[model samples]
Target: MMTNILIVDDDIHILNLLTIHLSKDGYQVFQAKDGVEALDLLQEKSCQLAVVDVMMPYLDGFELTKKIREQYNIPVILLTAKNQIEDKEQGYAAGTDDYLVKPFEPKELSFRIKALLRRYDSRADDSVVRIGHTTIDKKSYEVQTGSRTILLPLKEFELLYFLMSNPLQVFSRDRLIEQVWGFDFSGDERTVDVHIKRIRERFSTLTDDFQIKTVRGVGYSLEAKRS
Candidate 1:
């Protein structure tokens, strides 16, 4: 399937350049000039990835990314003129999956976007991600605990993969927002709570206890073990 991409930039020239390149690469493109319009469209449609400019009037890319992380798990590439390490760190903190300094070639950006999206595309087709007896099926969208096989919604499955991939690392909610949702998402920290709740409920029937850990105010971690 041709992936859907959303590009948000205030510069008409930059937006047009990206659109042309992305379309040539066989992606369906969507464009917006500001954060509010980007987030509004994101909420109403399905998208695989987003490329957002860091500087924009009203809401900047950092805030937009934080919002996206709250409700969606799409790849986000942040485009910024600020070259400082702290700025990059802030972008990562807000949930940008990748960062591109401004004045970059559109072709280069398209390549990076494809590479990022390919990781997700690969995971979606796998039958299982095995960690001991626990089985996570990417194709059927299910996670197995003991004898019970729990069905997973798309976001929940991606969450599981991210947690499982990282093992014991303590991820803050802000980081989870970035990794699971895109940087341009405008939801709140509590949104993560809701999804985690639903995921656990599905696992509950499969086992009296299972393996998604909460580190109090820190956030969540996934471990491969009996719960």
Candidate 2:
């Protein structure tokens, strides 16, 4: 299948430039003038990735990224003119999988896009992993235990799936963040801790088959318990 890429920018020149390059690279390009238009385009078309500009008229890139993160499980690249550290932090915090400063080479953007797509593609394998009585379904992004079915946020689900996939193996916060999020993740290790805490709290009463154990000064592991 040909990959679909959505480019959202108020700057017509930038949009055209990106569309030309991405299309040349064999991607089916979709164009949107602003974040609002981008969301509308998403509703009608299933894009594998989105390239969003930071300064849009209707909805800004950060807000658009947040909405996309909540509604979809696709990778997003934030395009901005500012190369400030604060802007990069805001972009990452807003859930962008990658960030690109304006005046960047089209080849660099293509490379970053390919890298993000590759990471996501690796995690898209259709497999069901079970630890004790709990089952983690990567295909459906659902968790099943006994008579209950649980749905978790995307990041939490990915984190749990990674740990459960390698049951009993300890993974440090840095490792987990790099594996679950991208290697370019700008957030600290606290991000992983927060996700782990939420996962534990959510499944505290849902199942007794598995536990996420913290390895002091290390990281976490999913230990299968006898039910």
Compose the digit string of candidate 2's lDDT tens values, residues 1-227: 99999999999999999999999999999999998899999999999999999999979999999889867889999999999999998887787889998889999999999998997786676488877778889889999998789999999999998898878888878778866897568999999989999999998988878899999998999988865
RMSD of each: 6.4, 8.0
lDDT of 1 by residue, 1-227 (tens): 77899999999999898899999999999999999999999988799999999999989999998888777778899999979999998998887889999878888898899899987677565556776666776667777767777777788887876776567788887777766785666999988889888888776556543377899978988766653
Cα-based lDDT for every prediction: 0.83, 0.90
- Taking all chains together, each candidate's TM-score versus the true structure is 0.65, 0.65
**What is the model-wide C-alpha lDDT for candidate 1?**
0.83
lDDT of 1 at 63: 95
Which regions of candidate 1 fall more than 4 Å away from where they truly are? 132-162, 167-227
